[model samples]
Target: MKKKTVKQSLAVLMVSFMAMTPFQQTAHGKSTVEINADAAILVEADTGKIVYSEHEDKALGIASMTKMMTEYLVLEAIEKGKITWDQTYKVSDKVYQLANAPGLSNVPLRADEEYTVRELYDAMVIKSGNGAAIALSEVVAGSEGEFVKMMNAKAKELGFEHYQFVNSSGLSNYDMLGMYPEGTDVNDENVVSAEDMATLAYYLIHDYPEVLETSSLTSKVFRPGTSEELVMKNTNGLLKGKSYHYKGADGLKTGTTPFAGSTFTGTAKRNGIRYITVILDAKDKYGQPSSAERFIQARELLNYGFDEFKTVTYDLDSIEKKKKHTLPVPNGKEQEVTIKVDKPLSIRLTDEEKDKVKTTLNLDEEKVNEDGSLQAPIEKGEKIGELVIDTNEKEEYIFDRKSSDYKVDVYAAESVKKASWIVRSARGIQDFFVNLF
Candidate 1:
């Protein structure tokens, strides 16, 4: 069974678009997206903002897209110095048989086939080659089962809360359930949600960008002397032609199974900005090009995000002008503090609307003594209170506590006496003498 290409299906209607502005910049940006998959999402690779989404939280069978996790784990191993690119891996009979086993997408390998770490990596990522994935997994761990344990461990370390892995190749056979005992079947395939997939894609590209080197290739060939060179072509059709014109459309991975449907995880970089889009269970409607529906939806969302919205940085100065005046403090005070506004508030709105963006300073209500300082020293970086922002009849939200670097010092008792006190005593004595007269 070979993985089939997802053809574009019915055109989906675009609705309820929200335009998010660059933080503290202008408010005219907009987001428009169209998608037909059971679940679709476009996220800012850096901010993890859902530029657009439909059924974004739904968990679905992602099919071979599970390979994305496999790739991530492999890259992580290389990064941690557990393995190297030039490392040699000997093919085992189990992995070799599984790699060559019937699958929709595979780079069949025979026993005794030896490949460098880099060559096998290319086959797995570039060719969507299941054989390559299993072979590499076996080499990294003593066996595929152990390699899968590593995969699950890596997923947990990466904070993937909504996913579980059962195999390295992601070939879960529902039809062949009777082949194994009821309790120990290989049918436990990897599963993930749309949000989880986006998160996975984000970490993969952000942390280990080198993985794309293989996923983005149009084709690849691996040769070890004495063995005929093996040739495999990339299954991702987007790289083969100039259809979307999306800049930086590099490699990621694609997956499909009868039960899981068509899935793709792709990364694109445009104008120094990068994004990862995942479409799970992509189905073809009538008259649509292969994967066209998904491609179109992904492109529109990425474009809207890149074109209309720009990242505007709101520095501490923006917060200072809003009102909280600093009381005099000891020297060496660090007045600087940063507040991260989750979303850009509209600055151009009506005064009433602007006023709605309220703030509450949670300063200590402790009184300052006559010594010109508070009775107790306020600890630096301590949360005295909070600054709350309320906008347009919405909930009153508390801003995070901001701290100053300097501590307050109290005036010494001796410093308040002597000449300064004598002058005060003389004035009191004069008033008393006048009253006696």
Candidate 2:
């Protein structure tokens, strides 16, 4: 019997388990911070990894946060060449009426006034202007009703099962549509889960990142340089030096209504890493300390995510370069071919669990020919083996060895061509002479 060394190649797959599982202990531990919201979630912008969650899948009224989707579609339309920023749209009677509605947040627009696409976008995102949002929807899709359909379709396409949008601005349906005709008890408010809202925030930033340019603005005037100048202040309290300002806080939306009670989808960037936080139904009624508890909860979640997790990059290129593994080739011009990992891997982990990370390589020896070599004519990217990684955590753990985690397929680095009979004979003679020396 012999003791195996770390550097030695093993004939069988290797499985190493640590005595103390850091991930399991961390998973079962209670959160240090309390979230006073009906539903809340925090996720990494790049990987979509959920760092902290509480009732994240509960569907609730999202108030003006619905405008995030409208903003996304408007930018998408511009990107697809369907519309332009400078294009002008005349306000309709319905849009005018909605803009001046008693309780809704809006930038007053006269039916006869014409506004550019850019002004409407700025008004909607910066001010949470419901009227501006509906007007923009009508301009893009011919009618607000048609635009709502588009929003729902896009939501479905994005893999959202717990969301429904009845309007572009997240306003209650009864308020926007004027009274249910008959025996209809369903309110026309947009309902979405915190998880889905987080997903939407991620996609909104991922696809049309330019929205942040306007969202980050503390204040701006609609119809600038014109007689009817309307100043629109951003509703997101976390931006700039606002009351609940968090470091690195930037563009995002805030929502509030009697029914929805202060929901927010906030994004921030620090040290090149971005995070999105969604808090729904955060109000003083829920034992929250203040009216601005949604923003406070969001900042707390962001702090937790940044402070607890660290991104780890598995430099597969360096790994492959260091471990020069090769496989013998039979009936070929070359005797062997080099192999390496197919792709690089990166994952987020806590400081404690980082030290437990371990990896193993297992080659499929059965693929080799009985003559102790691979059959020639090997392709450049032929998969010959696999690399398995373990962090001494259960499969259900957050950063376990899933498909999206630290796994890489080993492939042939170069192709191998078949050998000619004369070349094989010459190589044999050369090998014999070298051995004799």
Task: Give the range where candidate 2 is weakest over 10 consecutive residues by summed lDDT.
Answer: 11-20
* Predicted candidate 1 versus true structure: per-residue lDDT over 53-167, tens digit per residue: 5555555667677778778878878988988989988877665655665644666666886778887888778767776777777667766667777877876676554556666
Q: Per-residue CA lDDT of candidate 2, range 389-418, in tens?
A: 665643221122244335678888999998
How much lDDT does each candidate structure score? Answer: 0.57, 0.75
Off by over 4 Å in 1: 1-32, 174-186, 224-227, 240-245, 286-290, 316-437
RMSD of candidate 2 to the true fold? 11.1
Query: In model 1, how large is the Cα lDDT of residue 249?
Result: 83
Whole-model lDDT, candidate 2?
0.75
lDDT of 1 at 257: 69
